[model samples]
Target chain A: MNTFWIILTGALVAASCGFLGCFLILRRMAMLGDAISHSILPGIVIAFLLSGSRDILPMLIGAAVVGLLTVFIVQLLSQNGVKADAAIGVTFTALFSVGVVLVSLYTAQVDLDLDCVLYGEIAYVPWDTWQWGGIDMGPRAAWGIGGVFLLSLLLVGLFFKQFKLCSFDPALAAAIGIPVVFFHYLLMTLVSFTTVAAFESVGAILVVAMLVVPSATAYLLTEKLHVMLFISMGVGVLCSVFGYLLASWMDSSIAGSMTAVSGLLFLLAFLFSPRHGMVIRMLARRRMRLGTN
Target chain B: MNLLLALQDPNTQWVLMGCILLGTSSGILGCFAFLRGRSLVGDALAHAALPGVCMIFLLTGSKSIGLFLIGAGVAGLLASYSITAISRYSRIKEDTSLAIVLSVFFGIGIVLLTFIQHSASGNQSGLDKFLFGQAASLVKSDVVTIMIVASVLIGLTAILFKEFTLLSFDPGFGRGLGYPMGLLDGLLMLMLLMSVVIGLQAVGVVLVAAMLIAPAVTARYWTDKLSRMVVLSGVFGALSGVLGTLISTQQENLPTGPTIVLSATCFFVLSILFSPRRGVLARLFRFFKLRRKVLIEDVQQALYECLEEQAGSSRPGGVYLGIGSAELALKSGKSLSQVKSALAEMVRQKIVAERAKADGSSTWTFTPDGLKNSYLLVLNQRLWDLYHMNQNEYHHVHIDQSQEELAPQLTEEMLEKMLAQLEAYDLTPKLTEGTQAISRLYAREQGGLSL
Candidate 1:
């Protein structure tokens, strides 16, 4: 029963992150996604201070605001002649430093643990159950991450065509009167919400693994967008189950094990995927050489 | 007084010395990374060092800075290789590869770290400090290790400054020059990896990248030259280290790594907002100054065109007569207030004189020097346009508009040819007889002054 709740929480996180990761990698904004995850730490801490609890609402709003802010500032710096990578490095580190300072300063009053924030203990998820009207509702993380997963699925499904167009060619989208900037901020908002929701389950930094690795593997396997989305989410679920089992077996960090599993999956796809695998491509070239000879 | 007492403590001194050495090394090597547009490589390398540190501890059942450095160096090198390999062999973009390697390696590190914590000696190993460094824990031996590594880094950077510069700016050209560009690149990466590995003990894995990125970027805002940038970056980094260490020592719960990173960020913000050449304030100032110059030039050109039109209609008397501000505004297609302000500025410069009409409104006319200035301005405009039309090769060439004399820009033969071309097209600026009289008066005044 405990393993079920933990795996459920992990799957919800992987599903949401992997869904968004598809768009992020397609648009070449994967690092920006990583930056947003790290940079939102201050926002989460401030919200914790303001609410005096680990309530999800205030945390989500604060992190969403900061996440959009990260995107805005990165764009502003790059436009003003700062190199793109440096802009990302500067903005996120500065914000993350502030978060660390805040966390250390009020360590006593706040229940936020820096270690837990870095590498979350998903094992504890089954213990911290939420209650409603005197009845228990399993773990709070399952609900939170589940809500985010559904929100991403519904929104992404509704605007699938528009998002596809926007991701592939923003100029053509703009020419056809689609608000490119609007869709851009909308995507950023979803990414922020997903990141904050996944914070409890996968921690902050390792959530990037869930966000990028599965989608990147899916990207290698297919050229179709919908197929890529399905593959990524499927791989994300697989990582969750394997990661939970691996963590239990090794007695290690659950989020870390999940990400390590994703890494393994990506390695497999890199070498053996039928269409784009390096081994297959090499074989094809060698066969052509032999035939010509 | 409190600061004096704090600095007197040997513990504080060790921490300070260690931090300064760490900052200087990271800042110096960071310039090359920042210049090559590989700033995030530092972040990736920092995160990748964690599993290495954990692995060494697991294998040896003990911890040492030297062994950790070796472990971290190997891991960072492998991460870099994997990044390049993924991007090269697969269709994954470089950025996605960076994110992949960074997060996955960090995840693996976390796994190993947790496993270590569960071990018998895990609590005593003090490995969690590497996650968010505790610089207050530095001892004399740690400082010695940092000093030795820092000196080597500084010495190597100094010796290979020219080769590294070539590698950063143009590796292909360096290859053509018979330098082994590949070996040089690997050496620079090794230096970067060493700096990152050494810094992990003080600044931690999370914020060490900031030590590399912030000071170097701040230095970039202040200079265009690479040599000066490197020196300035090192100074900024060391200053931030001192500030971070001092402030952290004074407070109870303050951590040294974050405080240092924040100070470095403060320097970055200051440079972005206040640096002379590339700062936001300087760019804004130049933008407005250029706008004002363009405004004044447009008004002057419009007044000359109005005078030319009047001369073509009836007679040459309009040059001496003043035109109303409203009429001038209409001719210039500018607002009445804008035209009046421009005219007032011209009056202050003695380029134009204004007289109060019977209705108490101002009428403006150019003085002798003003007439000559406007004539040449109009003539240069027509001459350049005609030259551009005839000379397609020089279409994109920029002319120095600030020079008072055109002779420096165009040869005598070229000028005569351009004037002839302008005359053939009837595009030369026409001056009325009254304007010619004003020009002659200005010539005579100039001749008298020279005599």
Candidate 2:
């Protein structure tokens, strides 16, 4: 039962991140996603300081605000003639440094353990079960991630066409009177909410793994957007279950094992994907060379 | 006082020197990273180095800086390879590959670290500091390791400065020049990996990328020349390290890495705001200067038009008019105060003269030099309008800056060609028609974007 709860929580976080990660990778904003995860550190820490507890709601709100701010700062810097990558590098690193300073400064006053924030403890997650009128409701982390996953599903389902249009051709979407920037921020907000929801089970940095790895692997295996999304979500759930078992066997970090497994999954796709495998492509090129000779 | 006390301690002195050395090398190499559009690649490399450090510790059972650096370097190299391969061979973009490589490698490192922690040998190992460094714990041996690695990195950068410059700005050109481009690139990445590894004990994997980027970006706002930028970046990086060390030493529990990054960010903000050339204040100043020039030009064009309006029916302007502030204000579409300021400026430059009329009202008239200036200003405006008249829509013209001072000083042959061209458009000898052309151009400009 403990293992079930832990794996279920991991799967929920992974699926939501994987869902958002597809868009991020397709739009070539994967690193910006990484940047937001880092920059939200200050926001999360500030929320902890204000509430003086480990409550998840305020932290999610704080993370959403900070995530949007991260995008805003990066946009402002680029508009000021700073290069995109440099702007990303400067803003995220500085914000991350602020978070680090906050963690160090208010070490005793705040309940956020810096070590836990760096490398999360997924094994202990099941112990923090939610209670409603003395009924067992499972771990709060699982519920939080489950709620985020549902929200993402509803939002994506309602606005699938708009998201596809905006992602593929923002200028065209704007010409057609769709609020492209609004959609952009909406996607960013979803990513922020997802990051905060998964913050406890996956840690701050490893959340990027959940956001990028499965989607990138799916990107290799499939060409259709919806198909890629489904595949990545499946990969996310698969990795989470296997990752928990692997961690249990090794008695190691569950989040870390999950992330490592995601990478291995990507590697496998890189080599064996039916449509875009490296080995197959190399062989095709060699055959063409031989024919020419 | 705390700073002074820390400065006296030999241990602090060693750490300070170590940081300075680390800062200088990272800053210099960071200039290349900034130019290459690969600034965040360093962040990926820094995160990727963590597992290598843990792997080395597990294998050697010792925390030797040398072994850790080799391990980290290998890990970073592997990450770069995967990034290049993914972006080049597959449909994955460079940025996606960077993110994937970064998180995956960092995840592996974390897993290895967790395993190490739960193992028997983990009790004595202080390897957790690599995640977020504790710089105050640096001993003499660690500082020595940093200095050695930093010197090698700096020395290689200095020796291959031009090759690096070419590599950063234009890798294609470097390849064309047959400079062993691949080898040079590998060498630069190795240096970057070494710097991250060296600083792992002080700045940590999380914030090492900051040292590589902030100083270089701050320096970029100060200069355009690569050499000067490199020097300024090194100075800025060294200052951040020294100041961060001092401040953290004074404080109770602050880590040096984040504090150093904060100091570097302060420098970046300062440069962006106050640097002479590329700074925000400088840009604002230039914008205002351009605005003043535009206003003054408008007044000049208005004076020339006023003179033309008074000429006999169908006759050219051999006439002069002492226009009042109200008429000038109406003609230039400026406020009365704005018109007065422009007039005062023209008077100071002897471009216009103020006279008291018999009705006790002051009227402004263009002097001889002012007349010549106004005539040329009107001609240039007309020429621009006519130049784009052939196109379906008007386009904004950017005047050659080198010839800006020569606008009124066109030679005999050049003036003849210009006036002849204007004559062909039926715009010559009729001053009102030229003004009409300019108004039409301005109206088109104001309507909407051309495309």
Candidate 3:
């Protein structure tokens, strides 16, 4: 039962990030996802200090606000004449460091575990269960993460055309009266929501892996965005289950095990994908050299 | 304070010197990475070093920093090599390839790290510090190894600085010159790997790559020259190390890695917002000042055109027949309010005078100084326009900034050749390196090229 709950929590976090990851991958903003994950630290820290508890609402609101600020700062710097990557490197590190310093300053009294923010406490997920009038609702992380996953699904579904059009051609979308920047901020908000929600179970860096790795693996196997989205979600769910099993078998971190599984799956796809695998490319080159189609 | 004692302690001195050395070396190497659009490679390489550190500890059953660095270096190399190979062989774009390498390698590292933590190895007890880092654990021997690596990386950067500038600014040109592009790039990556791996003990694998990029990126806002940027980055890197080490010591439980990484970011934020030429604040000021000058000139031009439009038909100073804001706005192709505001400021400056009118609209005419200035602005604009029109080529990047400085005595024929030369040179900043010319053509990142 515990294992099932833990895997369910991981799966919900994975599902939210994986669905959003497809657009991030399409928009060439995977690094930006990494940046957002890093910058959310300061937000979560501030929210924890203010709320004086690990309440999910303050944490989500804080992470979302900071996530938007991260995008704003990056865009501000790039527009005012900094390179896009440098701007990202500058903002995320600074904010993340502030969070680290704050966590250290209040190390004694704060129930907030900073190390867990880095390494995650997914092993303890089953223990933090939600209940209603004595009725058990499994892990709270599962509910929080599941709620975010559903919101993302609804949001992505409703604005599917806008997100797709903007990701491919933002200028064209803007000309067609779509609010490109608003939609961009919306996507970033969702990214922040997903990242912070998962931060409890998977850690900040692991969020990057979940957002980027599965979608990227799916990218190797398919060219269509819709296909890639579903494939990545499938890959992500599988990673959570397998990763949970691997961690339990090895008596290690479930998040770490899950990330390792994600990597392993990507490697398999890289080396053996039927259409665009590395081995397939080598074979094609050989065949071409032999004067065959 | 404990910080004062920590500063006085000999062990603290060794750690401080070691961190400064690490910063200077990585700061120098990171300039190339930042310039060549590979800033995130440092982060990837940093994460990639983890599994190597864990594997080495498990294999050797000892906690040797050097052995771990070697393991980390090999792992980093494999990550970078695979990134390149993946992009080359697969249909994956470079960024997705980078994302793949980064996340996958880090995932494997996390797995290995968990395994070691769960294992019964005494040597691996403190290994988790490699993730967030605890610089206070540095020993005298660790400092010595760091110094050796630092000096070697610094010496290599100094010697190969020119080749690196070429490779970063223009790989095509480097290849055109018969340079071994792959070898040069590999050597650079290797240098970056050394710096990153060596610094792992202090800044940790999580934020070490950022320490590489932050100082270099900060330095970039201060200078366009690669050499100057490298030197500035090294200096900034060392300063951040000192600051971070000091801050951590002053506080009770502040870890050194994030502090050090954060210190570099402080320098970066300062550079991006406050640096003279490249900073956001400075550029915003320059842009507004230029636009205001252009705006005032537009009002003057509008008045002059209105005068000329009347001069040929109605006679002398008929242009000064008390022009209204609407007439000026029409002539300037600006809104009435925009023209009115310009007229207001000009009146305050005594460049124009306002007179009461019949229809309740105020009118303004140029003062003596205003007439002369307006004439000069008009003449300069037309000359620039004529040159651009005749040449059929202009960098819109320089159109506003280049007026009133064209050596007006030169003939049209001379101006044609000189304008092309000047336009290209203007696109590039005035730097001492020969590649500065080519970089101007290629590195237009500063002036919103390819924006």
List runs of model 2 lying over 4 Å from the truth: A133-136, A282-293, B120-125, B311-321, B335-337, B348-350, B353-363, B391-414, B421-451
lDDT of 3 by residue, B241-335 (tens): 88888887776677888899888887887787899998879889999988877787799788766644443355422223546788999888888
Model 1 docking category: high
> Judged by lDDT, which candidate is best?
1
Residue pairs with backbone atoms closer than 3 Å in model 1 (clashes) = none
Query: Per-residue alpha-carbon lDDT of model 2 for A204-287, expressed as tens digits?
Result: 898899999999999999888999899999999998998998898887899999999999999999987888989888888899
* Order of models, best TM-score first: 1, 2, 3
Q: List chain A TM-scores, every candidate, in order.
A: 0.99, 0.97, 0.97
Model 3: pairs clashing at backbone N, Cα or C within 3 Å? none
TM-score of candidate 3 relative to the true fold? 0.86
Candidate 1 reaches a DockQ of 0.86
Candidate 3 local distance difference test against the native: 0.82
Give the per-residue lDDT of model 2 (tens digit) for B1-451.
7678789999999999999998999999889988988899899999999989988888888887788888998899999889999888888889999999999999999889989988867453668878877778788998999999899888888999999999988889989988999899888888887887888888888888989899999999999999999999999988998888887888787888888999999999999999999899999999999899889889878866765564423333222336788898999999889888988999889887776667887777666566556766777777656544643322333345355443355556655766787888765534332454222211122221011
Docking class of 2: high
